[model samples]
Target: MATSRGEFSSSFGFIMAAAGSAIGLGNIWGFPTQTAQNGGAAFVLVYLVLAFVIGYPLLMAEFIIGRHSRSNPVGAYRAISGGKPFVPVGYFGIIVAGLILSFYSILAGWMVAYAVEPFFKLIGADDMAAWTVNQGNLSRNILFTSIFYLLTIGIIIGGVKSGIEKWSSRLMPTLIFMMILLTIYVLTLSGASDGLKVYLLPDFNKITDAQLILSALGQSFFSLSLGVGTMLVYGSYIANKENLVKLGVFVTLADIAIAFLAGLLIIPAMYVAANTGTEIFDEGGNLISGPTLVFQILPELFNSMGAIGVPAALVFFILMSIAALTSSISMLEVPVSYAVDTRNLQRKASTWVIGGFFWAISIILVIYFDKLFGLVVSFTTQYSQPLLGLVICIFIGWVMNRNSVLEELKKGNPEVANSLFMKVWPFFVRIVSPLLIVIVFLQSLNVF
Candidate 1:
């Protein structure tokens, strides 16, 4: 009863899923925190450079392996590396994907709660103070967390083509349309010039810290879903005829554009709302946190916009919800696809079972151990994600045969086989990629 190795119905569907994976909570929430902490425009520069160097080529490699192997991450790694010792790296994907989704579901649940904040006046003025004050409370946090789990389960029960794909196809376009509209509205505010200055103005002196550079690079990878098996799993469903290089570049551009645009809308609004010039950095020198930036910062911005605040607030949250759901579908796709491909499970059964497990796990995260949100964050970042990513990068870099990899890359772009770009790419794959990851790992662990 296992689902067959299915092909995407069209190139667009493949792009949507891949783009969906790239455009998740990280792009929306994580990107802004990194930008604000790292001195806005300066961080943007470092982020773009990292994206081109470390991110884009690896993304292309994932697609090549996926299409060439026509298998999930584990099987794909085994097939592509042949009898090489690096095949165990495929298990790294499963471990990272599972751990990521667990904590990620908790954050996604928060998005769902924010979307519904208006219903209880939890968003406006005095009501907001009470909500913010109780942000760490156990009961309220538990309720919202449970809601997140249920929503994820509901979507995952729909299966891939029906559940994940259908929802993303509808949601992604809606997200794009709404964001553009929201951007236009934000730009028209009376104080928008000041806000724009805060967002776009470069402050190089402040951005030189090595931590900021590292944060920017990390955001670039996380935002693109690069380190995880997300892109590889996405590549598995790709049709042979699709122009993969074109698709990879397009998706990367779209993901980066959205993150950049998100900052434009938010930072400008932050300035206009504060009225007095609020220093972008906090007094403690910690960058503003994510939930604080979104729930508190945005509501204040909306209030400053005069009579337009109410409708705009609704639109902004609605847009966020759509973006969030689009990305959530992609995360859910990883596990469900693996269950079907590896365990010989029916699509519906796989979807529900995997989705339900994540949901239940998130409830424990949100409800029982609410105090450990920081720990969850630490686990994903300092340990789980980097470890999983390091293994995969080394495998692609050192283990996969040069001739076979060249052949796969050539299929999508004829010049890739013989060009100078190909010459430099494998060198990075074999050496630079692994070395950089090792450095990042040690840095995260304070080992060096």
Candidate 2:
């Protein structure tokens, strides 16, 4: 059981895998749109602080516990608690992963559909191109959703170094390069300066707003892939010689950088859209957000560019699809790793079985699009994720001995004992992170 479970072949592979997990559809679509909907740079300022202060500590909780136990979230919890009730939390995390991927695959499918539409458009098959991007086409949605799942499953069936790491290394750089070029080009367009000003110049007064703070905190958690055991599973694969503290910082920064760049690319593009007579805001004056902003608003903006629009839209949706794929692979791995490590299942078979199950759920959600889709999304991400994260924090800070965590950190860097991380992190993970998460969770429910 111990020997068969794969380890990341190098620090680079792990960072690429882990960071790729963290940088997903949210960073590109949700984060920038949320920034615009909130107070723009004010929300970015708050999110920047929360990502490190709140997100990092919880992130390391997964890292320390995962490396110490060297197992999936379930095994890690049981190992830490010495066969106590905390084991259920691990199973709960696995359930959360499935539920998230169930709905998430649908969104990724939309990206894939949009990506494919440009090819049809290029071939002068305008009706086919129109059909691909039409949200009303259930067959199109289901088809692309299955395609996304197959793409994710294809990578996972190859195992760690060859599968997750290899694709992530190629995909992350490609995502970044395309992101930078798009940002530069969009910035060159007229009226993008308005969005640029909104993104870069903070409205300091709104930083103190409670809603912005809670939203930033929630985004930080979501963006880092914490509480879902994605990070925990990734952490389990890290080579023992790696400095986890350094690695954690690298992944977090990479996630943050991509999200920040998304703000640069996307928000500016929104203003550019507005300049071309597209409505950038809703009837209520809020910045259009979520799928509407991604699917409709942004696509309209692309279409207005005439002949250049086809290839540009292709590259944009492909970038979105790449971001979605990188993250989806990690989500799928949570269940696959559990089946492999604890259930004595094979990785390839486990991936297909679990991946197929989630795809089935995605199909169900697609069929019941008006009903189950949003419910599943809210349940998985908004509610269950923070609950799982809170539990993990409690496990490490309270259940596991403080010394045990210190010892795990010492594996890659002996200097961790004397470092500031040793002095501050234990306390932060135990108290600060849980409290912050609870606040965010409650705020999400409108209890405040």
Candidate 3:
């Protein structure tokens, strides 16, 4: 192994890669859906505050550990584990990352398939288009999931600067561009202004609701892809000369901006769909969420537009596919780095081997989708991630040596020495951030 694995080619490249990992299906679909489900702008307002209060601090904790060790997430944790039991927290994180990718690829596969569906339709191959959208078709699910895995693996095989950074630098801007164009298009339609009203105008009464606040906190956490070693791995790749404080703020802001921008598109489009007489809200008056919103409701909104609808759906799914791929590449990197670091494997071989393992798991989940899918998602994301995040705060806050942590940050920017972040973070990550994560964890227990 090279003494140095590799570094991101530039600061912009690093920012895009890190931000891309943060801005996934969650930002595109999950954020907006949560906004609609709660009291729209109220959720947005709370989520924004928590992004800085909760998300950025945890994010910095990962970056500090990551660059300090200059190793994989497991390796980084092991370097600081101080004991055996804590080591498993490192192992558990990659497991969560793997399980997350397994199901994540399945969702992204649908986006990939949906992106392709319009092509078939445009060519008059309506049957082929229908086949692509048919989730019950085992062949369809397997094929697209495989395609997504291959795409991720191909990028990984190219090494850090050439692969992950290069693609992220390209895809993130494209994703943003598409979101802007789609938002502008949707806003021009009749009734879209009503959605704009709901999305931008906060209902402070609901903002105080315990459940809504918890939901916003959870969205804030998960939207950044925290608790997974993905950020840690990305941090390990960051340059010593890069000012991580500025970089962290940049990535956090990018994530919030994109997720907020997605709300601009998604909510308004839902109202526009409602104007077309499509049932955008359920019997309880909550906006349709999860797979139903992406696969069914939004498609209805797109299709109601007549001739341009096919291409419109095409662009939207392509946008979703881009967002999904950017995140998947980062998730896949966690295990790939572990394999390379621990198993002494070649990065090329490791990407394929590890990606194939997750792909097989995805295939298995697709086969037993109804039974296993929800179980794995909840098990990995809901339970495992927050617990792992708790470990991160504990390690960075209470466990790791303070001088050592500052030494790492100093490598990137010496001025970080007396910064306000230095003044607040130690205490915040120690007491406040952990307490907030505990609240989020408790909320996940079905208590509101």
lDDT of 1 at 22: 83
- How would you encode candidate 3's per-residue C-alpha lDDT over 1-448 as one tens digit per residue? 2235878978899999999999988788788878877887888888989998889999999998888877777788677646245677888899999999999999999999999999999999999999999988999999999999889899989888999999999999999999999899999998899999888887888989988889889988899999988999899888888898999999999999999999999999999999999998888878888888899989899899889789889999999999999999999999999888877899998998898888989999999999999999999888998999898999888888888889888987898879998998888889888899999888888765
Q: Which wins on lDDT, candidate 1 or candidate 3? A: 3
Error of 1 at 268 (Å): 0.7
lDDT per model, in order? Answer: 0.70, 0.89, 0.89
lDDT of 1 by residue, 1-448 (tens): 2135676666777777778778876677677667766777888888888776667777877777777777677777666645345555666566556667777766665666666655455345657534623556666566666666566666667755666667667777877788888888777766777667656777899777888777776776667776667787778777666777788888888888888888777766666666644444477875465777776777767666656775787678777766766666666667777777767788777777777776666667766565765786687667766666666666666666777777766665767766766777777656765666666777778775
For model 2, residues 1-448, the per-residue Cα lDDT tens digits are: 3345878888888888898999988888789877876788899888988898889998898988888888988888777755368888889899999889899899999999999999998889999988998898899989999999999999999998889999998998999999998888889888899999888887878888888888888999989999989999988888789899999889889989899999999889999999999998888988888888898888988888888878889899999999999999999999998998888888889999999998999999999999999898889888998899998888888888878888889999999999998888888888999999999889879899
lDDT of 3: 0.89
| Superposition TM-score, candidate 3 onto the true structure | 0.98
Error of 2 at 84 (Å): 2.3
In candidate 2, stretches whose alpha carbon ends up further than 4 angstroms from where it belongs are 1-3
